[model samples]
Target chain A: MREVFQQSLREVQERLVKIAELVEDAIENATSAFGNSDVAIAEKVIDDVEEIEALAAELDLHAIDILARQQPVASDLRLVVGALRMSASLERMADLAQHIAQLARYRYPESAIPKGLTKTFVRMAALDVEMAAKLVELLRTQELDVVAEIRDLDDDLDELHAKVFEKVLSDKLANNPTGVVDATLASRYHERFGDHAVSVAKQMQFFLSGSLD
Target chain B: MREVFQQSLREVQERLVKIAELVEDAIENATSAFGNSDVAIAEKVIDDVEEIEALAAELDLHAIDILARQQPVASDLRLVVGALRMSASLERMADLAQHIAQLARYRYPESAIPKGLTKTFVRMAALDVEMAAKLVELLRTQELDVVAEIRDLDDDLDELHAKVFEKVLSDKLANNPTGVVDATLASRYHERFGDHAVSVAKQMQFFLSGSLD
Candidate 1:
């Protein structure tokens, strides 16, 4: 029974990593699409979102099934619960990325964001992608240190967000009022990107402490 | 052992409701703070986020105990897993609200978003407040139907968002760029509010179905 449960738990974890990869891809695609004003990339992200959502729903079911069938205890229970919680957050991360894609599709051809802030935007996007990837690492290895590490990376994202505000908000708004809306929204998205990083951090904390206890 | 486990599970449920209430208030506080450009109100929200995170951690511990002590299967397992998933999502929702608040605080006083869009902004705020409140109802009652009701209410929010967008984006962007930005972010918050509602709906689905299976 324990072996069956462990196998099921491992399968859930592996599936979660796969889903995380899709989420990472979606955010990167959405970022590139927005920065380049590429509607095609945005549309592709939109098309893939349903599959992501379905995968998330399916994963949650499997976790719940493991918990129900195996009636796991302590660390085992923590593992399944953590997987379920992480999947929900990751699903939202995908939704947020597709949301960014929707914004890109909405603003295409005549880009609302100023061209000058592309560098900052790309940097923010890279941070979001890396956070998603590293979160998967943290989950797979269960290196409790990664809980704190995710927060440190989140702080870096916060710094990036602050840079966008100080460097781009004032600079870009003064030059072009129309672009200011997109600039601010893009900044908001980047900041939100940081919060998702924090979300993963919190999940890792629960996983670590729950298992340890 | 079953009785003792249920006691902690009950405490978890009660605490979950408390956190839900906190998230509800945070959404309202952040929305109006953004609308009024009140940094102090937004600051209060930022301060309270840690409390939300802590509550979530405590809830996880309680649920994990229930799982370990009871070795719950079938219906009990479903309820605990669902509670676990919902609490995690609720925590993220609170964090997101704080993210919005931080955005408000960071850009305060001099947002320059056109003052004319206050009505639209307020409408969005109310929608967020409504959705959060409804989600609380759905969770506490264990009513999938209530979750569906929240989903139905989102239709109204969607219409309002669409109408606001059509007016805000299509018209002369040069005249009220700030208003557009403010309204846009407000709408984003509202949309996220709806997304969280969907999350509650999904959790209810799992909770309701897990028992039946």
Candidate 2:
């Protein structure tokens, strides 16, 4: 029974890693789509989100089933509960990616990065993609150091988010209301993608340390 | 043991209701502050978020303890799991409220609602507050009808969200870039607040119906 429970826990971990990988792909494609205004890649990210959501729902059901049958205690139980949360965060990450992709699709013939903020947005997208990759790594390896790295990446993303706002408000894009709206929404999406990655990292931290702090 | 589990479940329900009540208060105060640009009320909403966060954490701990101690299966298990998800949604709602309040506070002595978008924003804020209240009622009573009502409210809120974008892109606020940024973010925050409320309602539906659909 103990071995079976351990196996179920392993299954949970594998599913989380799988979802995280898909999320990484989604964000990568999303950023590429946003930066280059590639509607095909954007559409792919948008279409693939359902797969992530379905997988997340399936993982959640599996975790619940484990709790029902095995009744894992202490850290084992935390792992299962944390799996549920990680799945939610991963699912949210996919949603944000889709949102980013939609922005690209919305501005198909035009760029979403506005006039003066293209470089800033490019850096922000890179940061989000990097954070998604680190999240996948953390879920697979359980390395606590990766958690801090993810947080630091989020800090940088937040700064870029602020910078996007600053640029939007500056005279550089003063007359382009459409650019202002797109940049505002796009930057917000990129920043939130990083935030959800940090959320997944924090869940991993809780499981590793058995404390949310 | 069954009776003890029942007691624990009741405790979970009560805790969720408590948190929902606080969330209701947060959004109410937040919208008021946002509509009025009242820094004092915004400050209150900001300070109160930590309490909601702490309560949510405590409730999660309690739900996990119940699972550990009683090993509830089937519907009872669903209830506990649903509580965890609902707590997360409610906490997110509180954060969104805080975001709205921050928008108001940031634009102090100046209206966060741009010149022509004020009426639309007022309607959006009203819808959010109504949804929060309905969520509280749903948590307290478990009436499924409230779910449909919340969904309808979200639909209205989403329309207003699009309307805000339309107005932002129009020539109405052509020269006010600050107003454009603030309206964009504030509208997004309000829309997201409604989305989180719908999430909570869906969780309740899952608990009662044994399916997420």
lDDT of 1 by residue, A1-88 (tens): 6777778978987888788788878888888888788999999999887788899889888987776667776566666777777777
User: Which runs in model 1 stand beyond 4 Å of their true positions?
Assistant: A111-113, A139-152, A174-178, A205-213, B28-49, B96-113, B140-144, B170-179, B209-213
Q: Estimate, for each residue in B124-160, the C-alpha lDDT of model 1 and write its tens digit.
A: 6787788888887876787767766777778878887
Question: What is the DockQ of the complex in model 2?
Answer: 0.81
TM-score of 1: 0.83
Best-fitting candidate, measured by DockQ? Answer: 2
lDDT of 2 at B22: 96
TM-score of each: 0.83, 0.98
